[model samples]
Target chain A: MLQTLTFFALAGLVTIFALGTLVLRNMFHTFLSFLGCLLSVAGVFFSLQADFIGGVQVIVYAGSVAVLIVLALLLINHKSGDLSRTNLWSHKWLGGVIAAVLVGAALFGVIMFTHFTGLPLTGETAAIEPVPYIELADGLLNQYPVAFEAMAMLLLAALVAAIITTQADDKADKKAE
Target chain B: MEFVNNIFVNIADLCRALFVWLLNLLGLPVGLAEVAMVAVYWLGIVIVCVFCALFYVIWERKLAGYIQRRPGPNRLGPNGWFHTVGDAIKLVMKEDIVPDGADKNVHLLAALLAFVPPMLALAAMPFGEGMTALDLELGVVYIMAVTTLASLPVLCAGYASNNKFAMMGAMRVVNQAISYEVPQALCILSVIMVAGTFNLNQIIDWQTGNIWLVCLQPVAFVVYLITALAECNRAPFDLPEGESELTAGVFTEYSGMRYALFYLAEYCNMFVAAGLATTLFLGGFTGPFLPGWVWFLLKTFVIMSFFIWVRWSFPRIRADHVLTFCWKVLVPLMLANVLVTGVVVYLLA
Candidate 1:
């Protein structure tokens, strides 16, 4: 009973902050409110028994990464302090309404039949005894080695791209100097 | 991997038993034991965080000082042990100043925000057998998910500061975070695949007979560690808070206690990252002769010390260089590593 109440409370907090994110006039405030919404969403994740992913949501979403985004945003000096993108919201409200309607319809379609029968365990409480984390590690490295190789390449690519982007700016700054 | 999962499942059974017993007992009466346990859990987290942050700060400074061949905080406590504590006190006592035009509440919240998520993530970390704070059935998943909350507060601090450097740092964070997150998750999945379970306790258990996953998944371990460093924004990749350029990056406008919180959060983050890496790759709490908690602490600290060493040794890479290194260098390497692992595993089986 208490768990359900906490879930609702957290979900409500998320909704409220999300609404605030949209309604706030200040662009920065919007981001700030969105952070609040994200944190509460993490709370919802916790309520749903997905603690590991929830922690990632907090650290990756709320920690260094989001800070880096805001830090990037702060680097660009604006022409004015006013964050109001006049007429943009008014024009987009209909689009939002249409999106909301579509989303609601989709949710309505799925709410009635919560289970796709014959599927594996669906209940959050339906116990699947946790296999150890190392088994997963072994499976990756020794068992499913090809996928591991592919993942390495992916990270390498991300690194290269990040370096190139930052290095170009460094060159520009140095050239200016 | 099978053994690890079995162990975690067994441990979970015991935890459920204990919790059920406690709940049953609690249903009838309220005891100080419950409160003490709760306090111990949270307090353990807090004190450990405080000590980790404290030691990391002082340790980093001393390291930096040593590398630079200059004296660092030698006067506070012997070898400057109390330097961070003094600094903490000083920051706490300083005036809390809010910018006149900035939204006060958002700015205020941003300071405290970065500190919480890491602690929450810490809740599910397995310490040897049956020694963890909230053993989620989905322990590994829980740690990963809870950590996602941490990125937002960074963005919050940046935007609320109304500073250009902070904003740029925040934007880079968002972009880099999303990009790197994919690989981190994938690499983590590789570990999960081996164990056939997401529970961290199970992962640890899988290695009880001295079967550390690092021997088998060395490539995955390396990729994950590199990504973890980048994920934590350490050293060469720490563009967001690059001292030379950003003047403290997202934390520029923060002052006094707010700055302190960000500072504390930074070290806690570093510790958390190291802790997770140790848990995932280095056989969390699986050492000989020591208690589980001690083994866990020792391993995590050893990893933490390594990060500190690397930070002091390496020169800060350019902002673009940091990103490119991850994408072009780290990502591709990890991907190829994953592919090789997959193919080999299939053939062997």
Candidate 2:
């Protein structure tokens, strides 16, 4: 009973945070809202007994990536006037409608295809030991060793690219001065 | 032979009766005793998080003081043992400042983003046999994924403050963060060669009772520990908060309670990095006799103390220099370490 309540409460919070992320005017605040949504999603993962994935969600999505985005925004130092998401083309409402439709479709598909039909599981059907989420790691290393190594290589490239881009920008600025 | 069989049967009956008695006394219906068991398991987890957060702060302060040739805080209860508690109360009571034009909601939320990841990371960390909050199969990956949360709030703090310095600081941090994560995760995958499981408890078991991964995997340990320092953004790697230039970086605009929360999270994240280093490389609570949790805590505190020492003693490396070093040195070295661990594990197999 308590678990059901906790899950719904977290789901609601995620929705609120997601809304905040989209609608909040301040870029920084939007980032924070995104984080709140990520965290609540992590909570949902925990309730699903996907403990490892939950932790990763909290660490990677919430901790590193979200923070990185916010930090990236910070680097730009645009005034609210500078990037007032208000200046975008007039098709914003259409974009919103499309986003809403896509979300609804995704939800409907999950309900139709997944075991997550409206009803909660009875304890009898709640087969206890969680199916391993860690299979992703195994599948990554053993069956997909090339892909795994490639991710490492890609990250290496990201580092080099990030550095080269920043240094190039600095050099250009120096030349302009 | 009948007498011996009856003796075994009687022992089995006693065990069954005892189990029923235990269930009845546990405030659970007979069918839900396992749920009750889970509650008890998490109570221990709550205690570990609270205790570590509270004391680890004070310990870091002391270590910081010692390295700087000063007594950290000796006047509070018993060699300043309760100083952090006092600080907590002061922080809770402090009138938190929300700057004009600041989005109050995001301003508060930024601190939370910073605060949460370390707590989540702790759950996946394993101690001794049968000790952990929840061992998901993808423990290491989960931890790696959640580490992204640790940097978001800084960016939030910077942007929400409407300060250019904060923005510059956040940018510096973003660069540092993704750079370090690569080496850190690769190094851990190196160890995955031997353990064959992302479940931390299983990884520990693979390390314990004779074949500790650290002995076999020294380079991974070194690379992992260094990358962890960088990932945590501790000194030399702490370009985001470069006080000399950026004036505390993303945290410059924060004050009072909001500031305190971000401050606590930074120290706590250091503890997370240290704890992880302990688990992945240092035999992770595998020692003779002394309780496993005790060893885990002791090792973590030791690692944290080392970090604090280095933070104070070393000069902050330049931001560009940090980027150059991670790419030029740490990445290639750690990737090679991963290859070596995998090949060695295969050869032994």
Candidate 3:
């Protein structure tokens, strides 16, 4: 009962905020609404009892990523776009239709799988107790060391790529001078 | 250990059990009782925040006065014990002003964003054995994550106010707070590697009858202290709120209750930082010959006073120096400490 209530509450919040992000006219307000969407999704993770992932969601996604987005927005210093040109059946109509169809297909897939497989209607996937954090760490480090190493390597590569691009931009500016 | 077990731990548990029993007797559903427990837990944390702010604000002033050889707030009650409460009332009575150009909703939300995170972080703070409001398994990570939210309100207040100084201060705060967090997290990782758990209670438990992590990882201790000072925006790391340059910085346009909430949050953040330092390094609530809670308070105050003293004594660092020092010096030092500590812990085990 508690899980269902939490799911509905958080799901409603997520939907509202996601729509707010799309509907808001002001750019900064849109960013704030997007942050609300991210946080409500984190709440969904918490309600699902994936505490570790929920925490990482807050720390990594809502905290760092959202701040980075705001900072990027600040750098551009752009305000609200012109609302006069937002006709629904204009040049972007195909993009909207395709996005809606994609979302509908995903939803249909989820509903069909759950209905046909006799799975729980609620969001939880399994009844087993959560693997303790220690065991999770142990499994990652010992059992799936290669996967862990690959993840770390991917992050390192991203860092290096970012530094290289910034350096290249600086050198190009120097050359232009 | 005996002192700790016999004091607030038992009392806290007994009070909780009694509350649960009373709710059950009143024919409340178990779920309602659980919700009530969580509510009481958060309420207790907020009460602690207010209580800490009340005492620590005055304590900070009194200590500052003594260090500077002057009396501080000696008029209200005995030695101005009521000064903070009086100031709080004054703040409540004062008119709240939002600048004409301010984004009203964002400004309001900024004050709340600034105020709530420190209180939330306090929920993980352990006063004594079993005395935490919520003893989650990932207490350390939870504290770090919640405390990171502190920077957001500064950003919001800066942007929403549409003020130049506020904007500059907010930008500086983002850089300082985010950069210092790296060293802070690394320092915490060293302690976690040693204690082998993220639970604050379990970390303290590991320190019982053992040398505290400070002794084991002194470099990390120093790094943690510096980063913590930076984290709380206390001087000499308080460049973001530099009075000489920015005139109260991100809170330049704030007034009355909004200002008071910011003030309360700052002091509460100080208490939280000092409490964390004490727990991780000084072996929280573990001392000879005193009640556990009293010892905890004493150690926490000692660390807090050190912060106050440093704030009074040192000049503020330059804005550029703040980021450079953390990234170039503290981060590397903390990284090395964590690496060495990991090796040592592994060898010993």
* Strongest candidate by DockQ: 3
lDDT of 3 at B291: 73
Clashes of each: 157, 17, 0
**Better DockQ candidate (1, 3):** 3
Which lDDT tens digits does candidate 2 get at residues B1-349? 3343244235434554665678889765675645555555556555666677777778878878877889889988998888998988888888877778766776776776677677767767775545565666777777777666566667667666767777788777778888887887788888787778776777787778558777877887777777777777788788878889989888887877777777777767777787778887788877766667677778887888777777777898988888888898988888788777778778988
DockQ of candidate 1 is: 0.40
Candidate lDDT scores, in order, read 0.73, 0.73, 0.83
| Candidate closest to the true structure, highest lDDT | 3
Please provide TM-scores, in order, for all candidate models, with all chains considered together: 0.76, 0.76, 0.89
Q: Model 2, A105: alpha-carbon shift in Å? A: 8.2
> Which should have the higher DockQ, number 2 or number 3?
3
Ranking of models by TM-score = 3, 2, 1
Interface RMSD of each: 5.0, 3.2, 1.1
Which regions of candidate 1 fall more than 4 Å away from where they truly are? A34-42, A45-100, A112-177, B1-39, B65-71
Tell me what TM-score chain A of model 1 achieves.
0.60
Better of 1 and 2 by lDDT: 2
RMSD of each: 7.8, 7.1, 3.5
Off by over 4 Å in 2: A1-22, A35-77, A81-177, B1-47, B64-72, B76-93
Model 3 residue B309 lDDT score: 93
lDDT of 3 by residue, B1-349 (tens): 5755576556555666877788789987655655666777777787888899888898989999999999888999987888888999999999999999888999999998887888888888888766888888888888888888788888888888878888888888888888888999998899999998888988998999678878898888888889999988889988777889999889899999999888888899988898999988889988787777788899988999999999999999998888889989998888788788878888999
Task: Tell me the tens digit of each residue's lDDT in model 3 across A1-177.
Answer: 566676788889999988877777665677678888988987876665566777778788777788887787676664533222343324677778898899999999988788342112444545625437788888999999999999999999999999999899999999999
